[model samples]
Target: MDAQQWRIDVDREVCAGTGLCVGTAAGRLRLDAGRARPVREVVEPDQAVVDAAETCPMEAITVRSLTTGEVLAPEL
Candidate 1:
């Protein structure tokens, strides 16, 4: 069976290296060079992805549904 691949975006310029996303979504998000980035091109992120995006201090994370193209985070 194939899992639905989710899509997430992170703006390095907007990121503050707060580590909130990394903490909330451990395997899915990572802190590199003091910036937040997705570990992979989605692969099937959980609700923690959304929580991480929502919890971002800089609001630099954006989560979207790859199949439906629905924006799931930042409320826009």
Candidate 2:
């Protein structure tokens, strides 16, 4: 069976140049042009990535389960 994958997204328009996501998951995310972006669109499931998404002050980061299409971060 294939391992699960997660999809990370950051709304550039909503991002406020906060580095929280990058700080939370440095290896999985980075700051580009003062905005946070995922190192890769799709990645292996990672808690740090989820945490980063959850902690985004602008609520700009989003993490989803690729296999299930379930939103994984920024709990509503």
Candidate 3:
């Protein structure tokens, strides 16, 4: 297994499940029954993940740098 490089959180209640994040970061995000969730609780810090968070219509996805505790997407 690999160490988690980033922390990705999806607010299911806030997620509209429009698939914007999933579409942008298919490998990181998935939609189940119109509820959006991370493929896993943690993932390698990737640009696609950031893009997914940025493109979320509801701003429900949050990506943070595990090392720096910095919010990478949605620009806060």
Candidate 4:
């Protein structure tokens, strides 16, 4: 089976330091300098991460497909 690759990116410029992503996706997202940052450039974000992205009020978190360039969601 192909390893489904995923990536989580946080737009620090737009981030409001809400800490929602960190709270939602503690495994993949963290609060840095009051902004959200991805723990890794590429991560197989579990459901929590996806849920976190959805919960971002600023919509700063983005989840995308690494190989296909398909945006999973603007905020998830």
Q: lDDT winner among the candidates?
A: 2
lDDT of 2 by residue, 1-76 (tens): 2448889989999999879888899889898998888889899888998888888888999898887879989798
Q: How much is the lDDT of residue 33 in candidate 1? A: 93
What is the alpha-carbon RMSD of candidate 2 to the true structure?
1.3
Provide the clashing-pair count of each candidate structure. 0, 0, 0, 0
lDDT of each: 0.85, 0.87, 0.84, 0.80
Better of 2 and 3 by lDDT: 2
Better of 1 and 4 by TM-score: 4
Question: Per-residue CA lDDT of candidate 4, range 30-73, in tens?
Answer: 88888889888687747877787788898888888888768886
For model 1, where is the 10-residue window of minimal lDDT? 1-10
Return the top candidate by TM-score: 2
Colliding residue pairs in candidate 2: none
Prediction 1 TM-score vs. true: 0.87
Model 1's C-alpha root-mean-square deviation from the true structure amounts to 1.9
TM-score of 2: 0.91
How many pairs in model 1 have backbone atoms within 3 A of each other, for residues 3 or more apart or on separate chains, i.e. clashes? 0
Q: What is the TM-score of each candidate against the true structure?
A: 0.87, 0.91, 0.86, 0.87
Q: Compose the digit string of candidate 3's lDDT tens values, residues 12-72.
A: 9999879888878877888898899998867886899888888888899888877777887
Model 3 score (lDDT): 0.84
Error of 2 at 60 (Å): 0.4
Over 4 Å off, model 2: 1-3
